[model samples]
Target: MELEAKGICFRYMSKTAPILNNVDFTLKEGDKLALVGPSGCGKSTLAKILAGYIRPSGGTVLLDGKPLPDQGYSPVQMIYQHPELAVNPRWKMSKIAHECWTPNDELLKDMGIEKEWMSRWPTELSGGELQRFCVVRALGPETRFLICDEITTMLDVITQAQLWQTILDIAEKNKLGMIVVTHNNYLADKVCDRVIKLTDINHI
Candidate 1:
């Protein structure tokens, strides 16, 4: 199975230059791909498009030769850079964690989430703590592909390693395809099997 972007093209406005132009790629199941590029080069935009969060001006994102599901739980899940922006401020951590499906104790423990933290609001937890919830939330059983848009770039080294290990382990066990989008070439090289520069694919 593969998550493929076919002839992808996009722009925020008609007058503005295209953010992405004729981009394409395929990430097979269980394979990790690093999408590396300079800032404002549309890596994150492409990530969102591949995850079905944004509609492309031209072309389509296909998962195993079919379009991504429009309703219900998406097999393609995206974890953003800022955990705080991803969660509902009014919701508690427990609710956010269980928004998709209730994560088992083992999974929570592996993600380094303490039991008590679930009861607190999003504001109560630190960035790293909240990010743990975001990652776990995206790991619902229905998810087959993950769009990691610099998910660990803001964390301390130790926290980044721990969170990434947990994510890598789970992805490996489930054979999930992952698109790791980032500007950090070193981190991308360390985590992904294949590295693609956005400039190489995006004509814009």
Candidate 2:
């Protein structure tokens, strides 16, 4: 499978300067690409566009040469930087984690998710813990391309390493494509097969 964004352009409003301009990006099965750029350079915007979370102002995002399906779990899944914001505050961790599909015990254990944590609400878990749930949920069987938009930025070094290892293992096992968005060069080097600076593709 391949996720491609061709000649993409976007801006929040008509009056504002464009966040992205003629951006082109691609990720194929087993490809782990890091998207790096200075802050506010529209890296996250492009990630969202690629994951079908937001429509681009111009151009198209295609999965295997067709528009992403509007209904059902997207083949392209995105794990955001802020887990707290991604999940429903009103729901328990179990509900949130299994909202799409129930992950097996082995998968949860690999992600460092404890069974005890499942009974609590989102606020009850720490950032790292909440992020574990987000990662697991995004790794459902339907997910083909994973867009990790600064997904480990908020974690401690230990947690960061652990999370990345788990993600890499899952990707390798599933032959999943990944687009990692981050400003950390060391992390980009450690996690991605190739790193592309957003400015190199974003004409703006």
Candidate 3:
């Protein structure tokens, strides 16, 4: 499988300048790509566009040479930087975690998710804990591609390492295409098979 972004472009308003301009990239199955750029360079926007979270002002995202589906569970899934913003505050962790597909207990344990925390509310967990749930939620069986937008930037070093390890392991097992968006060059180099700078791809 291949995920392709062709001539991608995005802007806030018609009158405003485009943040991404005619950007293009492709991630083949089992490929891990690191999207590196400074803040406000449209890395997050491109990630959203790729995962169908938002439409680009121009261009298209293709999965296996066809446009991404407009409905149903998208093969492309994204995990955001802030897990708190991604979940429902009122739902229990179990519901939120299983919102898409149920992750096995072994997978949950690998992600450092404790069973007791399943009954708690989003407000009851720390950012790292919440993020673990978010990651597991996005890793549903149908997910073939993953767009991670600074998902670990807020966590401590140990937590970051642990989460990345689990994610990478799963991706390897599933042969999933992945895009890791971040500003940290070292982390990108460490985790991704290839890295691209957003500024280099975005003409705007």
Clashing residue pairs in all predictions, respectively, total 0, 0, 0
Error of 2 at 120 (Å): 0.5
Q: Residue 166 lDDT in model 2?
A: 88
Question: Which regions of candidate 3 are displaced past 4 Å?
Answer: none
List pairs with backbone clashes in candidate 1.
none
Candidate 1 lDDT score at position 74: 94
Instruction: Please give, for residues 44-81, the per-residue lDDT of candidate 2 as tens digits.
Output: 99999888889999999989999999899998999999
Candidates 1 and 3 compared: the better one by lDDT is: 3
In the order shown, what is each candidate's alpha-carbon RMSD?
Answer: 0.8, 0.7, 0.8
Q: List candidate 1 stretches off by more than 4 Å.
A: none
lDDT of 1 by residue, 84-201 (tens): 9999999988899999998999999999999999889999999989999999999998889999999998899999999999999999999999999887777888889999989998
| Local accuracy by lDDT, each model | 0.92, 0.93, 0.93
Error of 1 at 125 (Å): 0.7
Candidate 2 Cα errors over 4 Å, as ranges: none
